[model samples]
Target: MTKQRSDEPEVKPFKGPAGGWGSVRSLADILPREHLGPEAYRELARQNKPDGFMCVSCAWPKPADHHPAEFCEEGAKATAWELTRLRTTPEFFAEHTLAELRGWKDYDLEQHGRLTHPMRYDPGTDKYVAVSWDEAFDEIGRELKRLDPKSVVFYSSGRTSLEASYMYGLMARMFGNQNLPDSSNMCHESTSVGLKAALGVPVGTTQLKDFKETDAIFFFGQNVGSNAPRMLHDLRDCRKRGVEIVTFNPLKERGLERFTDPQNPVEMATLKETAISTQYHQLRAGSDIAAIIGICKFLIDWDDLAKADDDLPVLDHDFIAQHTKGFDEFAAAIRKTEWADIERETGLAREELEASARIYAKAKAVMAIYGMGITQHVKGVESVRMIVNLLLLRGNVGKPGAGPTPVRGHSNVQGQRTVGITEKTELVPVEKLEAQYGFKAPREKGLDTVETCRGVIDGSVRAVVGLGGNFLRAVPETGAMEEAWPRLDVSVQIATKLNRNHLFAGRVTYLLPCLGRIEQDVQASGPQAVSTEDSTSCIHGSRGKAKPASPYLLSEPAIVAGIAKRILDDNPKVDWDGWVADYSTIRDAIEDTYPAIFKDYNKRLFTPGGVWKGNKASERIWETPSKRAEFLTPGEISATGFKDADGRYRLITLRSNDQFNTTIYGYHDRFRGIKGTRDVLLMHETDIAAAGLAEGQIVALESDAGDGVQRRRDGMIVTPYDIPRGCLGAYYPEANVLIPVEHHAEKSHVPAAKSVPVRIRP
Candidate 1:
């Protein structure tokens, strides 16, 4: 382990809810660092508005009645970080070599600010040199033409707008490749797969308005404060309205405990916060399936007892008979589940589980909200289905304030998948796509994020063209991906700022700077506003009011058009240039491709509060093969298999309050009371003592993945925290190396980032 610097940040316990004056102080301190002036606040006010640009942060839905300041702390940071005055010009790259830049931290690399010009890696000088956009595109096209189409992987991030993603996906198919992998494969792929299998739809059943009307809201495995701060407002309102909020997670998040809305001047001045989470249950990591099964079993027993006493039935028998199938089988399975096993697996007493079940059984309407914590496990898909089963037992679906909702991590991530950026053959049928576009779309499914990593290592994938995101840093097993990515023939990054991915240049690497979400995008026809779908499936227009960071920067649509024009020049059926001229042309194409959902794409997109592409399950119109919402029976839960030895603990990766996804805004995690550094492991006090480790002691963590490959990460300091026993918490990307790349969810193939078995070593 590396020696700790004497200037390491202090660590203490935070006693307040997530948002308060602390957020204000943090915003004030960060504005000047990014060279943002008073105008930045005005710019933030325009975000998520009908005429303003959408925030590129979390995917939380915008309120119907837009607030003067709709942006959260993380959104403000993301906006300021992109619109900063500091520029990473060609001259800046000339001063620093790739090796020198590789030595810097991820935070420092992006803090150097927006990329201002197109650059190509020069092996002779070991630095990136300036190049014209056309030359870069031509070189990329030439390299791509040399390789087989199957050998190329086209990756898209969630920050991309629907119009650009549509063009990108179309271009990939027209180029005769199905290897389209997006950031969703790493984050919310489980939500898509699990929900589709249960409810006949991939998206959430409820809208943002449902949160206000919900009688009870269950938060499973999500830390809303840091990941989606705007959600705190809804939870606070629910608390004020006497709605019950129940939380189940390994670690106690401040946002779930209490939240003082920054928008409330009275609460802000008085320092009074609204208490959230009427019942908080600290379950073990990866034990969600067990806990859910226990709750269901208890509900079934309570219902049976109610019927025996000639009282009102606890279960919705009529809804079950009319709208669902396989309930009898599912109920039988739940009945057979032992309460002792549930108590052992979930690390909770039987009485506690029954109490929670009673609260749920009493509610008229309930909303089950979850995040990556439930979806980033080995049984993530099954866990998600269990959540659906719980909701279905109570006839929550197709109701006003009740359904299953997976709080997506990135803005427009769900939208990207909706606009044909998917690897599933069933989701985007190749035959339909080929018939519509006059191109031979590949029938076979493409590689997902984990498969892409394996493809890169096996020399099957030769090139990677990323639309946006830090792919290498964001994925698991960073140490292995960092090595495998540079071995590719060509790599292209369409981004606004410098990230760690830029340093991992292949034989031929091109960095094409693109317009940020906050910048105006003027096409050949006129100024255009790209549309993005929120967490609630509301497609809203996003038009940038701020000027472009650099004149050399191109719109994502324009860049995709340029590459498509060069690669598929012989294909006359594809009108790449026309799509780039006006974003509406692309939206028209989207409507033509997915007419059932995207009808009236252009007209409805401009409507106030955007258009709601309604979910079938939300309307009791199941489109499954059975024509009914199905009750999925999940397998048994094994909660004791995570440990290899008595001292081994489960490690769950998480984000800090000062960070959003892979981007770090600062070193301070105000909610967790950590400052100055990210190299720390959060552990229970008893676990720290059991491992013979003291507070602030540097240690190494080695995973027990059982894949015969040794995965270890060092230089992690042990810090006492309120985490569950036999579980440890650490920041992602740093802890990602400890997670084996091969270990992922069964069906969705999303990396099991939240539950890794590891042993702490001195």
Candidate 2:
């Protein structure tokens, strides 16, 4: 492998199609780097199989007819990263001080490998010392009891299984605190808020089979190649079947143009690829609201023309009248929107939006797909609702192959939310919990990721318990979290691997090593199988066949139960001991809580590819107050993207081809032609020339929120690319420092990481 520093970014124009030899080379380099052998190869074959562990990366659904290699390049990387032979034991921590470790890059810190034992921070020595599980849990419980329950924050990452997520949330409720927050707050809170309001549900309405039957698939800011590579297979088949694909994004991402499936013998042998997008529209960053409104306006104008000429109506009048409400007002808002505003905001000509609308109107079924690009903005919630409005105009929802689907990040982030890991108490079944657990569940709303960090900064939050995530690095204003983390009285992290999150230890911190998904988790009854819900609402079992990574490692469920057992000692109704002994007890408890969703839990969950627990929106059963799909109008139809002023440009923080959310797989982004570096900026040639800057010029970035706060990052090399004018792109988590914590969505409070206004200084 080439030894390259992340600071020295090298750019080469990648002429290869997505996947093909590029993806093959990626796996080849990473397999040996992570020290994988024949045993790991066998485990890779079992991924996404009937009785095997789900891919530990994206939440993309598995097909009913599972292929031998169902995982993607990123999935293989995640599995290899997890199953690495190298270990980070107490001895590793004793050698490195927190001050020295903090100076290392995220990729360098992660390369230390999986954690092996439970350890606590030694403040005097500024190092971590190994501790027993009993001592760690006891001290955590004592700290919780000492502080006000509301002051402690309970957080989890999407890597947690559904069984563990449910228990984790319930344990916090049992402790008389409802301060539950997970990774969803940073990524898809907009989707949850927007979908619940527009469709009366907070989950994806489309299934895996929908891809086969859809007439058109509309891509919005979702980079499928880097994020969910396995999805390219279904898309390749869709292209062969003549399904029209329209894409609207800031960059001409390699994933949206063409893809050559590596697993397909015909494609690999023939050196051929499938064309993905029929119509590609490049728009300004955070301008989806204007683009969507323009499309709606065009459709509404076509409908009016049809009415006047006594011709066929363009809109789906029958579906609208029968299934939807507020059509007249929604039409009024669209009609009042001007073409000039849309043109200026979206950075597209009038013909581009009209062409997109014409294709949408002609298609019988359309699936609206999006990712964090649309969600991590100030108007993220409204932007999602606007897309739903577009789908409703043509009745592209509640059917087999159409609906709004947020390509959720993380393996079980959606499942975690489904099983009560939320700050909102209303989402949790308080009545059912009160009866089952024999405790009065708290109803007061708690702080989310944004508020939790503020609480820490203000000295209100006293304790934090994390189940498998680098929370300190994932949130916005990362510098604020890094400084505030130590202010907390106690902190606990249950994790499989060592990362940068542990370096910034609190006064009393515990890093409890847990079993990875690829390892066998045996209980008192027998071997245990944990379950997770995918992006499509399919629930299935994932059991590990390999030996445990370390003898000291505990399962996530065991760690949660251990902490609860220490804190809620007098709770008679809650059987912490039995649940820990047998995972079936936990499954039974989850079934009791949501009987309709998880009926015949054990038998159905073990089914191949899992059973689909359809959302209410798919069945056209509105759970909203009016019992109808509401077409509520957005408060503003104005520009959503920031207008370039005083030389300030919009910065779009994105993931590299080799990285997952906040987890660096490597320093190479193959799709973008970036090698061995992440600290590089992607800009348009026009913008670079307009700013009088040359390619390869080193520069620093400063946030331009006008709050008089100095937030900046030094040493960013500019590289001109195909991104839209007045917009620049950079890698996430690394650029998160430039964004203030308070800059979040108006409704969902998700950090506006995708579109932070910034100025570049050479």
Candidate 3:
């Protein structure tokens, strides 16, 4: 097949729930094209099951009882993608120069398949030539020693396992650098900031079992089918048990309305789909904060009426008085907030919000669930706090059926943060490292994703070392990044495949090949078993069985250790070589670093569904300064961006059904009725008509950040969709160019990709 983008925008509304015959057909088409055989099929069956490798896709939790076909559509695709027989070896890179590769599309570049050997960029010929692993490691060490350790940015993608990401960070901290930025900066950093203030923990408090018992779940800004299709099974069973699922988003996503269980033979035979959401609200873009505030106001005002009449009070007075604080101020703010403001900003009626509140009031327990929609905004942290406030009004936290849950994007992203991969130097525990490894750890402040962009442009960041991620493509203002990226002194990317970010070769760059999670990683000591923490905070051990794509490929831990060996030659206390040879030693070191959390690491992790890492919030142990869950509200909740200002539409960037982050799996987005291209915009038909534009008008989108910078994305086909009247949606990464790096959540600094002010032009 040839790599091609459609010339015209194709639009056809998909009428059924996500995942049914459509998914089965997709899998059938994908398996043959990827050249996967029966062995791959067998491996797919073992995926997400006990004693098997976890799915490398979304971080959705696996069920306790696993079945033969426990994976979802994207999970199978990811496996087939990794396990392909195709190999992008040294010969292939020799044929294509870096200059030529730069012009290729992202999908075309990645379709070349797995990286088989270490390759270094040759500046003379503008091509990548094969290099030995020893030379690659030595060159990286030499380059880092030349610059200040603080100037080197170490980035980890969501795909990294626990042992690898942990060791990677340890190497950075031991080298007196704290610039450990990972994928969290791009997605759910807002959850960390807001939840820390509200629940005293940055992670979700609920376990998989909570879904079975929860009476209701409020979903905000999440497209279930496209993001995490496996979650539909849980929603299916919950729906059968009469659980109310409420969704609030800018677009009317099909996954939220109804979902078909592909594994259910009876339902598939009858073509029957299970009803999912009881109420779905198409709220204005970036107005999750205001929409949720409306619900809080409705609940709080109703509680006032019940309290005044001496009837059954809707407020959880006992729980609030005992386990919460700042309730009076939070309620006062909600009550003082007018319904007109909420209705106007949310593009929702007072009656709709009140109706949603009635369902919440009647339910015994409700789970507050959200995705990037709630987090990637100017007020993302505030939006998360609002969710916490609404849940606290009903005594939802620390309960069996309820808590705040962020639908994280990557597998093991939460685990990466747990095991010391963050820019916040405080998370490193300097004294702890000194005692464990006899190194003086640096507490110097470091750059995040946004700061890294500034650092790259201003020449403060001398080098960047990535553990499996496309930095330039994933970051905001991609146009700016592409121009300034090559100015860096060094770039080292340890990845499984080729990507566009790899093309932005700095002055000196090395592309090192690393073993995928699906490949066997055998060391001198024995077979290695790495672990990853799912969204639920449960740790599962994953061991690969298939032969590696190439014998030259090394595990991520091995690669990190090789570099560490050269950089920290004098640090005898840290056993870099031994830890790589025996992954158990890394686990032992992880246990030493975080004894309270990773206690009995090896024994507990290798168990049947892995072990629970213990949620501090769920245990009702508030590690907060106030010694209780705090209700922190912003001083001012602005409602400006929710409505169109000066003919500028609020744009929300999203993923296609075929893509995962920056990795383009295919061109078709079956769930959204989009086929053959990702470069298109989704707007309400009313908005399209209002602008005197037809459905498929080719236009250029520009962001008015008022910074005198030209942030434009042209050749986008206007795709009128079932979105809010004043909002527009487009595929991410392509839309990333329009977002300014400085425009991010105030507290978390997550890229405000979900809410950027943009205007379309012909």
Candidate 4:
């Protein structure tokens, strides 16, 4: 394995749906190498039974009653990983050099097999050699003890279980450091930052059940079917009830238009697809600010018309006067924005905007759902505020079926943030440490993912212990982070399989094999149940079924507990053994730490689903200074790089049907007719012709905002699409090459993945 790209043959266009059996056919080539056999596979599938274990793939809510084929296509791939027959033995690692492994494709790494045991890189041989778990722990402990607390950064992925995340945070705090930058730091940090500023909370306000009561759903920058297929069921249910679903995106995705659920037998057998969107608008990326402003302006105008004619209620005047502030400023700002500017930026006509506003005015309840598309802009935080402003204008925050929902990406990404996986200013994590372990936590807000990479490049940060995730590829400015890795003193990855980041090991690197979500987790006490927080802030348990692939596959919590005990100074109060032995104690500790939030964790979690928090606090009670939801007007519209560039396209990063976030299950993006390729851009035919480019022609995309950054991903096939004029879209991680690391929102450190300025050349 040298640093060569995957040499698989160019893929043919997607023919049809890869049904359960058809999907298995697609994996035929790799099945011999990756399949764990029928016995293991069946057990793995059984383990995915509703009561057995949660789906290791996406965070889509499961049905209360078990459905036989409940898992999605991507979920099956994740299950396959758990039940894979291949194993990464010490001998195999000894045969391949680190440099050689660097050439492997992203999929090939996972295809290699489950890592069997702990391994340390042997600089002499340029390959990894077997290392005893005890030895590896001792080595990491020694390296951590030597580095200054400030020079080390601990990173976690969304895959980490809640208990593991809490332990990781506790371990870092005990080591007198709060330099914790996690996966959430990259994706939904803007949601947290924006929602917290407007609604006094950082998480989504609505749950899945809320959709059942929704009268109207304003979906912004989200592809419901592709990103979250389970949501299609809810949307389909709503559609059946005559609920309106208005979709806004840069491109017209087929999944958004019609979705045939694999779980529904009637639809699956008849090959019938459910209609999803009632009104689909091709919103230009980066111009979301304009779209939101237009909605606000329409609301204001409706109010004025209502007042003059004595017709009806346009703005919720009663709600506004009783429960809000700063309306005059918001109203004045709305008045200042002209319809011409809104139409120009949003690429929507005045009539369409008016029609949408009319619907909003007439709706008794409205729910707005958004994803990375809305949060990955230079003015992303402001765009989020606009959504809040719209909701606040109608008293949508604490209602039954209405509120802002930022559809989260990862399984436990939201949980990780809630468990204190953050780089806070006061380093209050240390204060918690002192209260629990009798040690003062550091008093510095550490660098986030982007800042940590900068620190590594500048030599301020010398080491990183990533609990999980592909850091190099996931971070913006991949070239910089790749170069910076070699400069670090130590780098460690506690993971299940090899990823792109594992190959970019530093001077002192170690890959500690850990258990997957579906593998059996045996602790000193016995089998343990790991807790996870859903997108709705509901906590539940996940238990593994299949036997560990190897005796060495330790659970995440066990791995973290082992490292915590070995690295930190021994404290009687810090009972690492007790915590690892019984996860209930961890829950107990969590309850103690956030009693008002996690009261009766044990009793409540025992129920079939789980319990909800903030119910009492949500009823017309704001945590803000005034104890009421505030209407903060961003008086002036924030300008983005898109406005100044006349003909340049605003590129948005998207995940293919076969992918999830940064993880590429395979190259085939089935729904879009793309297969075995990441080197392609989706664009409007008009935009292509306007740029003097032809379909199927390869072109380089130059970014004016990327500050001369070069995208090595050349020769990308172009496909004529119904995207908005001057708007472009491409797969992320590859598109990460074009987005500069420094390009970020002012308030939130989230890199702009939605609104990027670029020009195409043939």
Q: Report the number of the highest-lDDT candidate.
A: 2
Off by over 4 Å in 3: 1-5, 638-644
What TM-score against the true fold does each predicted structure earn? 0.98, 0.98, 0.98, 0.94
RMSD of 2: 1.4
Preferred candidate (TM-score higher): 2 or 4: 2
Each model's backbone clash number:
0, 0, 0, 2
In model 3, state the lDDT of residue 553: 95
lDDT of 4 by residue, 1-762 (tens): 222243342534443443423444545533354555776556545543545566666666555554576565666666776678778789888778889988777777776778898988877888888888888888888987898888988999887887888889888877877788887778778888887767777777887778888888888887654576666667877888988888877877665777665666786678766677788878677777677788889889878988999988688889889887788888988888888878887788887777777778778889999888878777778888788888888888788888888877777888787777888843234455568767776666777877887898789998899887788888887777787787788989988878888887778889998888777777777777776776777776777767787997777777888788777888888788898888889888877766776788876763455456664224666666676676767644533544656767777888887677776677666667676567778888887777778887878776667456575546667877667887788888887777777787767788887877777766
Off by over 4 Å in 1: 1-7, 638-644
lDDT of 1 by residue, 515-562 (tens): 998888898898888889988898888888688889899999999999
Residue 143 error, candidate 4, Å: 1.3
Model 3, 1-762: lDDT tens per residue?
355465545778777778999999989977887777677987887788778888898988766687569899999888988998778999998898988998888888887789999999999998899999989988889888888887899999998999999898888888878788889999999998889888889988988889988999999988888888888888888999999998998887878888878888998999998889999888887777778788888888888998899989898999999899999988888888888878878889988888899899999988988999888988888888888988988889898999998898998999999999998876666688789888788877777899999888888998999999898899998888888889999999989999998898999999999999988889989888899998888899888887888999999999999988877856777888888889998999999889988999988776776688888889778878898998976555542233357688888898988888898888888888898788888888888888999977889999877788988899888888888887888988889999988889889889988888888888
Regions more than 4 Å wrong, model 2? 1-4, 638-643
In order, the Cα lDDT scores of the candidates are 0.87, 0.87, 0.86, 0.75
> What's model 3's TM-score?
0.98
lDDT, model 3, position 721 = 85
